[model samples]
Each structure stands twice: as C-alpha cells, then as structure tokens.
Target: MQFKKYRPYERVENIQRDWPNNHITQAPIYCSVDLRDGNQALVNPLGIEQKLEYFNTLVKMGFKQIEVSYPSASETDFGFTRMLIEDNLVPDDVAIQILIPAKKEWIKRSVEAMQGVKNGIFHLYNPTNEFQRRVVFNKSDEEIMNMAVESMQYLVELTQEFQGNVTYQYSPESFSQTQLDFALTICNKVIDVVNPTTDKKMIINLPNTLEACTANVYADRIEWMSKRLNKREAVILSVHPHNDRGTSVASAELAVLAGAQKVEGTLFGNGERAGNLDVVNFAFNIYSQGVDPKLDLSMIDEVKAMYEKQTQLQVHPRHPFVGDMIFTAFSGGHQDAIKKGLDYYRKEHCQEWNVPYLPIDPKDIKRGYEKVIRVNSQSGKGGVAFIISEFLGEELSKEEAIAFGHMVKQKSDEVQRELSKEEIIALYQNSNRV
Candidate 1:
C-alpha cells in the first residue's frame, strides 16, 4: 500500500474560533436517522413491523424529530410513511423527516408519500463537494447552486397546496469535504427560496458525510457558516456527522459548542462504514455532566436489547455507555480504587456522583452494582472483599481479605476463568473451616 499517496484534508484558516472557550450548557435538538441512514447500512434492513416498533420506542424516549425514511427509494419506505400518517401513529409533537435527493421526480414522490402527515420535515440533499462536482456530476459551482435552489423552490410550491404543517430542511451533502464558502452559499440560497419566517424555521444540515478531517475543523466550519448564514433566526443550524474518523461524537459536541442547534444521528451509531454518531453516547455524555439531555435513556439496557434484536447487531462490549462491559472492572488497581470510591460514596450519603472509575453510577441507568467488581486472577484484595460483601453479604477483616484474595487468584488461575459468586462463597466457607 502506498501510504504516502493521500494528502491531509485542507484546514479552515483565518477564523477567530469561539467554540473552544464555549461549553455545551444545554441539549441540542436530536433527530434520529436510524430508519434511513442506519437501515440502509444493515445487512437485513428493518421490516415494516420492526420500523414501526422502533419508531414508537423512539417517541417514548422523547425524540421530537425522526428521519423515518427515504420514501422515494423503495416500496417499503413509502409504505411505512403512509402507514404512520394513515394509522395516526405519529404523535402531534413529533415531526417525521423524509430524506430525498434534490431532484424533481424524487421530490414529488417524497411529497406524495408525506401527504396527510400532521407534522413533517421534507429533507432535501445533494452532494456539493469538489470531487463530486468535478468528477461525478461534472457540474460547475453555479450549476450545483441552481440544483439546490430549484429543488427548494419546487418543494415550497408543493407544500403550499399540501394539507399539513410542513417544515423544510436542506443538506449540502458532504459539507465536510465541500469548500466551506460553497456550502454556506448553497444553504443561503436554499434559505432564500424557502423564505422561512420567524415563527417557522428551516433546518440547514451540515453533514460530515465522509468525516474527512479532525473534529475541530468541523467545529470551525460550522461556526464560520453560522456567523455568515442569512436570516439566522429563521434557520435551525443542524449537523449530521459520520464516524469515519471515529470522532463523530466529538465533532457533534464541538459543533454544538460552535453554534449547531440540532443533531441528526442513529441510536447506536448504526450507519454505513464506521457508522453515524451514537445518540445514546452523546446524550449520556451530557447526562454525566449534570445536564438534562431531554431524551429518556434511563432504561438504556432495554433500549440496547431492542436495538440489537431488531438490527441483528451487537453493541461492542466497550461501547461508551450502553455496552455490557463499560461499567465492569477487572483490573486490580481499578477495582481497588472503585471499591474505595463506592464505599466512600455510600458512607458519606453523597448527593453528587464522585466514584473514582465509574463516571455516572450504574444505578442511575438502572444497571445494578453486581458486575461493577468481578474477581479474577488479576483481582485485588479490595475487589475480592467487595464481591464477598456484595454477593455473600459478609465483611472481611483486612488480613482475611488479603489471604482470601490470594486463594481466589490461585483458583481463578487454575480454572483459567472468572469465579462465580457461589464458588467464592464456597471458598470462603472452606477457608473458615481450615
């Protein structure tokens, strides 16, 4: 492989960036694109029943905006949209978003699918990156701008005759790769066509469709565009960052700090390639920082179970918040510190979470304290003592704990697996007899 063939992505220069100094004090508007972006990437896309169930789950979890599907692309997608509208499955507060390319026929088809919807966001997108323009479409800059403008104009015209509350959203697709000026210019033109009023706002989604650069660059670009965009009050600046560079969450957070008011993502970052930003991870990150994320993720395990079952995908054991092993401690030092911290927390009747290794208490997310410390060959005396106290309801003296920890380590090494609660208790009983 010729590793030297690739050049670094260009940097945004000559900007007085303020996102670095600013903090994300509040939650951004979250739009789950699981049914569209996440479904498209799945080996077996979600059936209508699964989609319906997932939609209901998302609503229950406090999502007000959901990009349900690209209705023009498939019969299933179109049918799902129709079912939601006809069955009155969509809630009054939730806005269902539909993704369609910025083309005449597709726009018409998307609009047709959204007929009778109470609240809908007609999301239009077209790739405007330099490579896509020069090589793929062979269109000039003016031609690209005209495509977005014409489509926005047509959508505005169609919505006038439509019988629903319609919201408009435009994405300069691959905004991360596109020149920042062109991205801003195209969004501004689309805004002009939409002519949004103060009461109603249009969404301009700047997506890192390929996630080409570092997160800081994306934040810089978002801030730069936000500062220059026309009719700022009448527009909702949104971001949809992919995890190609494994920093989608960081990019989204930084973007929010920079000026993005909304974020579009999937539940577990399930999308093409590395995936979209994990909304669960993002929300919980805020929750840990003492902010209300506005999403009801308290029963995260149930959500993970449903997502895994429907998507036929496993959440990685180390996945930020919802993964199986995220709260588990197997390392000796970590276990010891966690045990001390947890003990201090309980003894002090602390109101704020200040455990050493555990960020937010496992109990906060309905995860019990059972697996927080597990005994293994690497387990320390503190961990063994914790396990005994947790599972067997017995307190051990310091010397007894030290001796028992050695015996547990030897047994674990001999068995070449972690010991169970019963086995640890049996060992404790046997040692007492001796």
Candidate 2:
C-alpha cells in the first residue's frame, strides 16, 4: 500500500502551549453552512424551496449565523440570497452569510444580492497556502497578500453603499496549510484596512480546509494566531474544520479552548470530501459535559429527517449524538450497569445526572429508553430481569432470572442475532420454567 510514501505533518515547536490545560467553558457562536457547504456536496443539491425549508429548520434550531450560499456562483445561489431578503424570511436576530471570491465581479454581484437584508456577513476568501499559491495561482507572496487586501478594500467600499448592517469575514482558504506568519500577515492586513471596532467586529476564519494535521496542531495554530493577531479583541477568531482526518470534532473542540469564538460547520458534517465538522455532535459533546449548548436539539430526529430528505444523504447509524445506536446498549454488563444506575438515580432523586454508561440523559434529546438494552448470546441475568420488570410489569426472583437468562442466551445463539424485546417476551411466555 506504499504506506511509507506519505510523510507526517510537521509539528508546531517552541510555543508555550496552554490549550491542553484550558477547557471550553461556553459554547461558541455556531454558524451552519449546510445550505452552502453541505448542499453543494450532495449528489443533487436542494432547489430554492428545499433550501428555504432547511434554512427555516436551522433558524428554529437556534443558529444565529447561517451561510446561505455563494451568491455570485450561480443563479440559484443569487436568487436564494434575494429571496431571504426581499421576502423578509430572515429573522431579525439571525445573520445570513454569503460567500464571495476575492474577484471584483463576484464581490459586486454578492453585494447586489445582499441589498435589503437587515443583517448580513459578506465573506471573502482567497487561497494562501504555498502549494495553492505556487501550483494553482502561480502567484508570489506579495501577489497573494495584495489580492486579499485589495478585495477587503473593495468589499468595504461596496458594503458602504448598502443600507443593511453588513459584517465582514475573511478566510485564508487553506489557513491550516498556510505559513503561520503569512496567514497572520494577510489577516492583519485585512483588519487594518477594515478598521473593525468593538461595536462592529470582523471575523477571521482559519479553515482546516483539508484537515492536514493532528487536532493538537490545529489547536496550536489557533492559539498562536489568537495571541498574535492585531486588534485581537476587535476580531472574532473563527474556525471552519473539515474531517479529512476524521478529527474535525476534536479539532474544533480544541480550537475553541484555544480561543476561537465562532464555529462554521454543517448540521451532521455534510460537505465536500469527508465532510465539514458535525456541529450537532460537537454541541452535544459540550452539553454532555454540563455546559449549555444553547441550541434546542430535543427534536434531533425531526432535524435528521429533514436533513436527509433535503440533501439525499444518510446519517450513519453509528454517528455520534444523533445516531440510532448512540444510546443503545447491547453488552450484558453495560445493560446491567445502566439498569442499576437508573434505579439508583430514581431512588436518590438526584439533581445532577450521574447515570452509568450514559453521558447525558437520552430523554433530554427526546430519545426513549425502550432500546437501551437488547438481549443477545452474551446476555446476563440482570439485563433479562430488568427487561421483564419494565416490559411485563413483573419482578423475577434471582434464581428465576438466572434460569431465564440461560434460555434467552440459548435462543439468541440459535438465531445468531440480537433478540428484540418482543421476541424475548414471547420466549418467556412460552417457557416451561415460567
């Protein structure tokens, strides 16, 4: 497989690292790029009607910022932007972000698309990584820097013509791969030109674009940039991590601890390639840790249904948080422990959740306890006893439970599959031991 052909990513050195000791005490500002990043990656992108439906879902789910589309990219994108504005579909508190390239024509069209919106973020991006600059654009360092600076200047001028409140967002498209010093240089240059104040802050988004390194490296880069950027308080440090390395969630978490205040991701990590960071997974992780994610995810099933319908993409059954099996337990020992924990929890009337095997209460996200345990060949007496007690409203003696457990195990082995609760109940009803 030529495994040795690939070289490891360079590690950050000589930096006083602090993110390892830091904890994310609060949720970051979440911006769903589902309509743009997620939609574009689909085999069939959503039409305007479907886009509106998804946008409404995101708004209801409590997102303050949503990247609707790249207006200048296509007619559909442009029309969606105007639809949200002219139709007054955007809520007063929500900001609709439109992506634009550093090109002048695209920026002009994007500005036109945002004409009457109350709150908008005009996002401008240019590739700055050495590979992209040399291979893709064949431009020198000065050329790339000038492109970003000039684009910001032009965007500032065009935004002044609009009547709506417009915020500026700049992404060094492949910031994770770009030289840290050069990345800082370009971002500071844009900030200098934009002259953002505390009242109106600009966003500097450091995107992992390809998720090239380990999560710790991403955190190191974020902390390094956060500490060094000029007018740091006047700029919101943001991260847009991709999942090429399957660590976007970890990278995003560490980045937040490192000082990023905004996160740009899709609902369930839908995007190009492996996909963008899964915002739902990231938020639920925080929620499990006792921090309020500030989003109502209690209707996760409904959200997943709409997302799959619109994008024509399926959420993996094993996907974290919203996955079907996330809260399900099949291991006999695990099921037994969970049963004991629930019993203890109810008897103590505990204010804090400390249930075994469950990080956060399943009911908190509108999931039921019906599937928490499933009988299999490895089934034990306690799990079988609990199932009988809960489903049949009958208590089994210790000896009876042990006898039934052996029978259930035999049945499961014969079928070579996990037994449903109904199947187990039927077996119990027909058993001579019963």
Instruction: Name the candidate that leads on TM-score.
Output: 1
Check candidate 2 and list the clashing pairs: none
Q: Where in model 1 is the C-alpha error above 4 Å?
A: none
Model 2 regions lying over 4 Å from their true place: none
Per-residue alpha-carbon lDDT of candidate 2 for residues 1-434, written as tens digits (9 for 90 to 100) = 99898888877778889889998889999999999998889889889999999999999999999999998988999999999999999999999998999999999999999998899998999999999999999999999999999999999998886777889999999988899999999999999999999999999999999998999999999999999998998999999999999999999999998999999999999999999999999999999898999788898899999998888888898788788888778777887798889878888999999988887888988887886777899879878888898899888887999899989999899999998999989999999645
Tens digit per residue, CA lDDT, model 1, 1-434: 99799989898899999999998889999999999999999999999999999998999999999999999999999999999999999999999999989899999999999999999999999999999999999999999999999999998888897777889999999888899888989999999998888898899999999998899998999999999999999999999999999999999999999999999999989999999999999999999999999998887888888999999999999988888888998888998889889888999999999998888899878889988888889887888888888877778888888888899999999999998767888888888722
User: How far is 64's C-alpha from truth in model 1 (Å)?
Assistant: 0.7
Per-model TM-score on C-alpha atoms: 0.98, 0.98
CA lDDT, every model vs. true structure = 0.92, 0.92
